[model samples]
Structure formats: structure tokens, C-alpha cells
Target: MTFLKISKAAVIGAGSWGSVLANVLVKNGLDIKIWTRESKQVTELNEQHTNHHYLPGLKYDERLVATDDLAAAVNGRQVILLVVPTVAIRSVSQKIGKILQTSNERPLIVHASKGLELGTHKRISEIIAEEIPEANRAGIVALSGPSHAEEVARQDITLITAASADVAAAKTVQKMFMNDFFRIYTNQDIIGVELGAAFKNIIALGAGALNGLGYGDDAKAALMTRGLAEISRLGVAMGAKPQTFIGLSGVGDLIVTCTSVHSRNWRAGNQLGQGVPLADVIKNMGMVIEGITTNKAAYELAQQRQIEMPITQAIYQVLYQGCDIKQAIANLMQREGRSE
Candidate 1:
């Protein structure tokens, strides 16, 4: 299947990643529009060329524009990128489906969000397919990897994965966003790609909790190594390719998120380790800590599948139960030793 050139695209959220993606399109000479629910951001992005609240101190492209009206942002676009938080994806997708159902164009739908739906345990691709009618979509794609919006905004060299059951759709997206500073690889294991991307946050938060508790680098290293093991176990149980965890979407994303200063999940966990209440840590963050919610979902999933996920279980106790981070770490440390 071939098509007309992907000239104009719509990025359906104006948060940090969304804004950076919109600017990437502009950098690649595509006409782009970013939709935000906040009216103030429209002026800030369109007039001032900035997004101070979500992505401070970064000057966006003047050619890139923003709007509060979702319909105006998406109509007639060749590619519609969903960059909203995991919780907000369903509602936004439902709205997009209604507006575009009768339209003539079947635009490529890509999601950059990383997290499973809490109750359904669904990936982003599944959620989009449920809300957006297949007739109105070219194909569903999951764009993920070790990409931090903070670094991407600086035009730092980044490599990422674009995965879809539809190989053509993945290739289309790879070309759409590839540039000198950013590159893309295509994958067919959508399940492994999405799961690895989402599950790494659990490990990152664990790393931060260790840091906040004044633990040495040795402890963090153990957590990351063991973290990948459990994440791969659960992913395989759920039909994902095991090797996908060793690839960019898995270990690569895990390292960056667990170690990067820009990781909000790690920061939130650090605050928790420093004795801040979970509610207070989340409020102070002023950003969606995907791992906080993902912990609940992954823990429940592990139980359902009877998967051994000690790290996820420990983090879940800290976030959901009243278990102290120290106690959680202690519990993890006392687990039965197994050969690697």
C-alpha cells in the first residue's frame, strides 16, 4: 500500500513530548499543528513559540502552531499523533474517532504514550484500535524507546523504535520523523515494544528510591538487572518477543529512565524515599508519573498471570500499601536467591 506524501500532520497533545514531536515535524519541513486542552498554551506556542509549563526554557518553531480546538488541529492531516497521558488517551481517542469517522482521509495514527490501561491492562495500540474506527485510520503504530522529551527538545541525538503489526505503517512513521538528530528503527513486536517501554518506569522509580535513600551505585545496578529479568518474564507471558526487552525499547529505555535526571518517575520515587507521602510527591511533581499508575496495573497483571515480578511487587507495596521504601527494599533483599 502506497499513498500520497505525508506533508501535514497533527500532534494531539501539547505536553513536553507532544510539543517536541510537533517541532520535529516543523524541523523536517512538514506543516504541523499541536492540540492542547489548555487555551493559554495556544497563545504561548503560537505567539511566543514556547511551552513554559510543560517544557520550560525551550523555544519552539515559529512555524509550528497550537490550538485548543481538537477538530481544527486534526482535520485533513496525513498523520495524527496521540501524545496525551495514558489515562487521557481513551477520551481523546473517542473524540478523535467521532470527528474523523465520516471524513475522507484515513490518516496514520501513532501514539507516543507509554503505559498500560489500568483496568484493562491494554497497550496504547489496543486502546486506540478500540476507540478509533479502523476505517478512519491508516494503521496503529506505537512509537517508543529511550527518548526523553528534555533531551529531544535540545535536538540531542536520539534513536527510537516505531512498531506496528502493519510493517508498512511502521516504515511510514520511521520516515516521517527520522532526521539528523533523531533516528528510528522499525519493529513488528508491538507487544514487546509497548510493554518494555511502559514497564521500565517501575524500575526507574525503584532506582530513584534507592538514590533518595542514599544507596550506592551497586544497589541501583542490581535493581536494574533484576528489573529487566522480571519485565521480560511478564512480557513473554503476555505474548511479547523476549529479545525485544534487550533492544532499545527495553534495556535502552530502562537505563535512560532509571538514570536520567529528567525522569519524573525517578524523581517521584526519590521524593518518596526521602519520606514524602505518595500523594504529596505526585502533587509536587506537576507531571504525570506514569510509573505510579503503571505499578498498580503491572502488579495486578503479574498476579493474574502468575508471573514472578518481585521488583514490581515491592514498588507496588510502597505506592499502594503503607510499606516504607526501606521495608520494600528489605523485602526485596530477603528474597530467595536464584541462578541468573
Candidate 2:
């Protein structure tokens, strides 16, 4: 079957990632529309070409339009990028589904959000499939990577993955965002890519906790390595291609999330380790710390699947069950020795 070419694109959710993605599309010469829940942000983007609330000091291209109306944003679009937080994806998709049902044009959907739904434990793509019909699911894709919005907005060189069961859809998205500084690779392992993207944030939190405790590179490195192992194990069990974990969406993303100062999850974990309450940390964060929610979801998934993910379990305890960070670290360190 021939795939549709994507020229006009709409980005749902005008958060940092959504704005950066819309900017990149506009750079590639596509007419881009950004949808936001906040009417004030829409006004700012329309008037100033700046998303002052989330990504300050960055000017968007004049070709980019921002709107609070979902139908206005999605109508006549060939591609839609979902960048809302995982928790909000369901409600947002439901809205999009209603809007899309009214339009004759069927746009390819791509999700850039990274996290598993907490109670349902659904991947963003899975949630999309459930909300949108089979016809729409055929056009679904996921783009993930080690990219941080701050760096991507600055047009720094970044690598990312575009994964879909539909090759044409993947290629369409790959071409939509591919630029000199932003390179995208295509992969068929959607589950692996999604899992890697979701789980890396949890490990980043662990790394940040170690940093807060004044631990050196040795400890952080160990946590990162073991964290990847745990993620890979679960991914493998879930039928993900093993090699995908070694690629940009996996190890590369894991490194960046765990080490980058711009990581909200890392920052939240650092505050937690510094003796701040989770509520206080999240309150001060003023942004979605996906790792905190993902930790809970991953822990539940591991238990359901009978997968041994000690780090995820530890993070779950610390974040939810009132487990102390020091005790969590000691528990991880004292796990029974095994051959690597």
C-alpha cells in the first residue's frame, strides 16, 4: 500500500518538546500548527513567535501557527505529533479522535511523549490505538531519542529514532524532521524504542539520587549500566529486538537523561535525595517529572511480568512507599552477587 506524503503538520501539546518539534518541522519547510490547552500561550505564540512560559528566549518561525482549538490545529494536517505528558495523552487523544472523525483527511499520528500510563500501564502508542480507530492506528508512529528540548530548540546537533510498523509512515516522519543538525534513524522495533524511552527517565532519577548523595562517577556509572540491563531484560521479555536497546533510543538516551542537568527527572530525584519530600520536589519542579510516574508503572509492570527490575522497584518504593533514598541505595548495593 502506498503511504501518504506528510507536508502540513500539527503538533498537539505546546510544551517544550512540542514547540521544538514544530520549530524543526517549520525549518524543513512544512506549514506547522501547534495546539495548546492554554489560551494565553496561544496568544503569545501567535503574537510574539515565542513560547515564553516553557521555552523562553527562543523565537519560533513565522510559518508556525499556534491555536487553542483542536480541530483548527488538526484540520487539513498530514501529520500530528502528540507531545503531551503521558498522563494527559488519553484525554488529549480522545479530543483529537473526536476532531479527526469530522475531517475527511486522515493524518498520520506520531507520539513523542515518553512514559507508561500509570494505572493502565499502556504505552502512548497503545493508548492512541485504543482511542483512535484501526484506520488511524495504521498511520501511528513514535519518535524518541536522547534529545533535550533546550538543546534541540537551540538547533544543536541531535539524533533521534522514528519507529513504526508502517515503513512509509516512519519515512514520512523521518523526512519531516530530518535537517543538517537533527538526524533521525528509522527502526521497526516500536516496543523497544518506546520502552527504552520510558525506562531511561527512571534510571536518570537513580543517577540523580546518587549525585545528590555525593556519589562519584563509579556509582553513577554502575547504576546506569545496571539500569540499562534491567530495562533491556524487560524489553526483551516483552518481545523487543535486543539490538534496539543498544541504539540511540536506549543506551544513548539513558546516558543523556541520567547526566544532563536539564533533565527534570534527574533534578526531581536530586531533590528527593537531598531530603525533600516528593510533593515538595514536584511542587518546585513546576514541570512534568515523568520518571516519578513511570517508576510506579514500571514497578507494577515488572511485578506483573515476573521480571526482576531492582532499580525500578527501589525507585517505586522511594517515590511512593516512603522508602528512604539511603536505604534504597544500600538495598541495591547489597543485592546478591551474580556473574555479569
Candidate 3:
């Protein structure tokens, strides 16, 4: 399929991931503007060429501008990348939808955010579809995998997946973002891709908690392996292809988020295991730990669907119900044994 010609793009959210992705587009020779809620961040990016809060010491290209105006960012851009946190997806998409209401432009809508919506358990794409009308929407694509903003900013080799119901749309994103160090793969199962990206964070929290408790390689390996089983079970129940869980958004993302120091979810779990309160961990981290909220959503989803996700249930209990960390592990260990 022939890809749409994209010369310019708008990236929503000025967080670490948004900044890195906007810079990537600029490096690809596309004019890109980033929308941030903070006016100070706009000045910092436009004048100083840096988002010191997120990507410290990393300079952005001159062509990459930052704006506080939503319309200014979304008005003429051919592509809009929603890089905001999952919690903000609906609000941001509604704002963009209002702007696109008066126009017939169908710009490609690409979302890089993970995590299911609270209360509704809706995916990011579903949230976007709820807010944006079909006429104003060109296509919705999910750009997911293990790629981190910090690593991508330094020109590290990053691999990602672009998933869409429309193959051409996925290919367009793949073409626009691929470089010598950054690679893109296309997948048709948006359900599996998004679920894999979101569910792995829950397991990563468990991994971090185990590490904080000084559990060695055996425990960590068991947690990860069993975590994949539960994640795959839930994803398959929700209409995702089984193979998708083994790909980048699945086991691949699970590994990085579970083991890496850069993972806020893992870090938060580690803090909790080290005797810190959940509230204190979130407050001290100074960043969004997606796993906390995602844990609630995933646990509820599993319950509603009658799926067995012991790790998710334990994590949720620890976070919301004030279950003791050590006791939680004991409960998990005491569960009935089953074949792998």
C-alpha cells in the first residue's frame, strides 16, 4: 500500500517520550511542533532548545517548536502523535476533536501511550475513537514496544511496533519514524499490541518488588515467566492473537520494564518493597508510575472476565487494600500448584 505523504507532524505532551519522538521526527527532516500544558516548558524548548525536566542536556532541533496552544499544534499538521499519559488521552483527544470538528482534514492519528483507562478498561485507541469523529480521523495507530525516551534521545538502536487495523497507516508510521538506529515493525492486532504494552508494567512492578526484597535470580525468573503466562491469558481472552504477546510489545517489553533502572513502575515497586508507603513512593518519584493505576484496571478487568491473574491481584491488594508486602508474597507462594 502507498503511504500517505507526511511533511509535518504535531506531538501532544512535552514529557520525556513526546520530546524524544518529536526530535526523531525533526531528525527525519519533518517539521514538528510539540504541545505542552506548561507555558514555561514551551519557552524552554523554543528558546533554550531543551526540555531540561524530561530530557536533560539533550538539545532538540531548531525546526522542532513547542506550543501551549492546542489548535496551533494540531491545526495544520498531517500527523498527530498522542504521547501523553493514558489518563490524559481522552481530554487531549477531545480538545483535538473540537479543533478538527470544523475541518475536513483527516490527519493520521498515532498514539504512543500505554495503560488502560480507569473505570472503563478501554484502550488508548478506544478512548481516541470515543472523542474524535470518524470524518476528522484519518487512521489510529499504536506505536509501542520497549523503546524508552532517554535511550532514543542518545541515538540508541530502538525497535518499535506500529499496529493498526489499516496496514497502510502502520506502514506510513514505520516509514516516517524508521532510521539507522530506530526500526519499526507492522502488526495488525491492535488489541494484542496495546494489551501487551500495558499489562507488562503490572508484572514489572512485581519484579521490582522482588528485587527490593533481595530475592535472587530464581524468584525473579519465576515471576517473569509466570507473569507472561497471566498476561497472555488475559490478552487472549480479550481477543488478541497469542503470538503478539511473544513479540516486542509482549515478552520483549516485559523484560525491559521489569529489569531496567529506567522503569518508573519497577522503581516504584522497589520502593514499596523497601518499606515505603505507596503514597510516599508516588510522591517521591516525581513522575507518573503507570503501574499503580494500571494495576487497578487490570485487576478489575481480570475479575470481570473471570481470568486468573494472581500477580495482578496481589499487586492491586498491596497498592489499594494495604496488604502486607511479605504476606502478599506468602499468599502467592501458598496458592495451589499447577502445571506450567
Cα lDDT of model 1 by residue, 85-187, tens digit: 9999999999999989856658999999999998999998999999999889999899999998999999899999999988988998899999999999999
What are the Cα lDDT values of the candidates? 0.92, 0.90, 0.92
Q: Write the per-residue lDDT of candidate 2 for residues 198-314, one digit (tens) a residue.
A: 999999999988888888999999999999999999989888899999999999999999998889999987887788888899999988999988888888889999999999999
- Model 3: per-residue lDDT, tens digit, 50-80? 9898878999898899999999999888899
Off by more than 4 A, model 2 = none
Clashes of 3: 0
Worst 10 residues of 2 by lDDT: 131-140
RMSD of each: 0.9, 1.1, 1.0
Which segments of candidate 3 are over 4 A away from where they belong? none
TM-score of each: 0.98, 0.98, 0.98
Better of 1 and 2 by lDDT: 1
